[model samples]
Target: MKKIGYLILIICFLSCESETIETTTVNEELTAQQKTVTTNKNEAVVIRFIAGLSEAEKSVLRTHYGVTAYEKCSCGDENLESWNLEAIHEGATIEERVSSMEEEPEMEGADFNFDIQIASQVPTDVISGPIHYQNVLPKIRSQKASVTVGVLDTGIDPTYFRFQQPFLHNTVLDEETCGNDFFGWNFIENNNMPIDDNGHGTIVSYMIYEQLVNTATDFQILPAKAFDTDGKSTLFRIGCGLSYLIKKEVNIINMSFGWTTTSSAIIGSYIKEAEHNILMVTSAGNTGENNDEIAHFPSSYPARNILAVTAVDGEIPPTLVPILSNFGPISVDVAVHGIGLPFYTTAETAPTSVTGSSYASAKAAGFAASKYQEGTAMAVFYHKILLDKIQSSTLLQIKYASYLDL
Candidate 1:
């Protein structure tokens, strides 16, 4: 009997081991495929190297990898630096160059910024109850303050009626004079026009625009077009946009996009670092998985400045949680209802209804921006004040997996 019991234990252990190995192999395979799809086969790729490059090191990179341009990035530490570079070499693949560079002592931490796919969710318009913003304006007018909110997504259509409305005039910032940027828009494609060929950015930007307008708040929208017409961008471009916003001292940033795989460590590092100073608001993704169980970058990152938002539906005793919106008690910070909400499109197009945590994130970001206070201490306190207002006990009851109770 003892021998038989020992045999059963061994069999159970072997079976569990086999299952674990199989699961790991499948996960690795899927991850590899995702990485491959994200790779752009274009002649050029973006690379970030350990910073503080000597003239000799820069010359070596220029000669060896055909580096065309480079910029220094401070990944949290001003003293510790990182360099973003655009390079082209006919013979070698990006992976090959990365591996070769890693073997060199000086270039140990060199890495490529992989492409980031947009979190696309087309919203359809629906007649909904009032959100109190239009009414809330006059009451809070005395407390209103000027704030800058950076929309890091597809470009906004400033010609739209919401932007053109006389009451909302001069809310959009003047074109940035910085390198490769334009007034009210900046594109990663190096094009002078930052128009939205895809409607996602326009829709996302409107959520913030409408909120500020309705509340009669003094605010400016800095539209940074990191994604292209296909709704695609890379960590390199996104990082550049973030750097631009940081330099401008924007009080809040809205990133209504994300990816599942931990593909770009450098970009992840940037997100983590940005939270040190600016309020970073991001979507919790649409995967429907618990982010705490399966992490999401920028959202699940352990940062006090990050407000990870998930989606809820219907207000008057809100109950529905979008089937696709990711949620977690620990990972997600708040929830907002944007599903089936009328989204503003281009001047030529009619408004449409939209879904996904993308809109939720935008709404939260706009709310946070509306509640912005000037001082560093006020910034923290006011953010909490806004959160308290948002996480009402009644509303908290309706949110899925929400930890915030007010």
Candidate 2:
């Protein structure tokens, strides 16, 4: 009887091991195939699934479908047995499958919304015209002439025509490998060179340079790479990136990335650093949710040295705020053009249009840099100039050109 029991246990162990090995092989194969199949390169797919599965059940599902990563809910609960369906179905049409799945009653309230859209069209005349500089540049140009504004977001496309003569100092790349000290680096590629694989950083860079700097008169940019292709980053990596920028003593730092909340210690450190006369500019996020209810870190931190900005659309008049712009009486300090903003693409020849609070933050940073002056007094001076501009504008006026028509 004992020998019979031992034999049954041995059989179960071997069966489990076989399943594990099979699952590993399947995952490896799927990952290799996913790399080759591309769809909606601009959008990232995150899968969500129902929870409350036993260990055996999860293993069975993973082995059966070869699942590798589990997507988490906004509440931080892990949804086991989920997969990036887009990746899993690579090369094959899964729209029918997705449609059928959506029809199921179990998924009625469990469905995830992937509604983020990147703007594709911008006013060519506005982008090509020199009116931006003629109207806005002279007021703040002399103040920012010598200030170093660091952009901590996606890496910049150095070859872009608009930035052909940008005052860039890269903090991402390691000096030993790139041979140049100021070129940006990418931690994702494990290299010193930080060229943008995604166009988000490039677009943000141009908005700051072309609109703010070119208009302001004489301000330069310091490019700092932070987020990668997926538009995801952690507080630790952000801290490391900021440390590099601090060492450079940049006059202004623009950050377009943030989570609902971040470590208090990290936030405090940033404030302390800002007190040293470095102005920090950040986005108010794009969720369109109430920031007071769900405070975003870095931006939410109450620091006198930091300025939190929200987005506005350029299609509106200069005095009105953009409809999509996030606002809070306390959290957001000001608003700027955040939608359908023109910027250069990775192609290096012509410009592409994109939008987000990321662009708004860059605009604010560039505007501040353009008016930057040495000493704490100068820092306060530039901040006031920007704040005054925001208060003078109204929402309706911000989205229409008629306000500027006069």
Candidate 3:
């Protein structure tokens, strides 16, 4: 078993929303395949329990170790078998906590920012044009069950005109709007309203919403506002957001954010728990680094259900993505057109653009939702579908998998 991957990790495991308008055509044509852990002023330490912690261990952690401000990550009704915790460590350093923790029942895993924001600010290109819509209609119509996609990013702009369509009304709430139910839970503000204060979730959701809207009308997006206004998040918040999604039992989940760490075992465990139930899509990350060489959490977590996406631009599958995009035959599964695409959200009067693997992952989630069947090993089955569709090309940029151009 892997030990704690410490904050400056060589670790992994780990782990958005939008609106509608003219229906941004994300994948018009074929394409070639493709944050930081920070400390808070409060100095809280993050831990993941492989098995729920026993009362005795908790007592030990608090009494002897000077751990305080304990908080357990909770899902709505779904009790997660494996759980994550946040507590204020009184130790001088994380290394001190670990060294002194020698006698504790084998620390499963711990870290500060297991999963941080996937930097989406690198501008690859600015798209401006007449705004052409390509995916005129959804792909699958008469499916057995309607698909619900979990958007794990900043809260979505629920008021977006496209998201307000009658079809998505029930999905927006996910549950009954008792007093003031919103799209999904907000881990940041501790409220039901996960409305997007930052534009990242809005844009990410726009790509997904446009794709799903074009493909099928029965789809719904369950937005869990994981990131705050600064596009940053902590492990506890991310775990909580994921827990909410898992409890909601969505068909597919789009994780547009991730951090780089070789020691992301804690986050990986949470995702590992969810892999059996939901199909997950994540960004391959920016920084123009090779994911094959470096470690990018969730994307590089080596899970079957998680599909890591990289960005591309335009109609034909590009030989290479923008300089900011990360690619790897091993870590990344597919590539999509998430860059240079003009998108309009409720926050924007005109089409706007930004660069990140977040958009590409959203497109993949939307596409997967369009193709998702009711009863199946969704993660494995959909994963195979994407991998099989991979165009057999050179292993230059897209080393193993092919670029997805639909």
Q: Comparing 2 and 3 by TM-score, which wins?
A: 3
Q: Residue by residue across 1-406, what tens digits does model 2's lDDT show? A: 4345334534543454423100000010111100101112222222223345565754564444333444332111233112444444434433444444444332211122121222212222211211111121112122224567777765655554456554554222222222323344454343444455445566667777865646655556655565665454443345545655665667778887665532234335545746657888877676654556667656777776677776665654443243445566667776676665544333333443555666777777777766666775745664464544633436422211111110
> Model 1 compared with the native: what TM-score?
0.67
Q: Which whole-number lDDT from 0 to 100 does residue 247 have in model 2?
A: 58
| Superposed model 3: Cα runs more than 4 Å off | 1-42, 50-57, 74-93, 99-108, 122-145, 167-182, 345-350, 387-395
Candidate 2 regions exceeding 4 Å error are 1-145, 170-180, 315-323, 344-352, 376-379, 387-406
Top lDDT hit: 3
The TM-scores, one per candidate, come to 0.67, 0.56, 0.73
TM-score of 3: 0.73
Worst 10 residues of 1 by lDDT: 21-30
**lDDT by residue (tens digit), candidate 1, 68-176:** 5554432112212233334435777556776776565554244555667676464323222222212211221122137878888876554444554422212112232
Full-model lDDT for every candidate: 0.57, 0.49, 0.60
The residue-level lDDT of candidate 3 at 86 comes to: 30
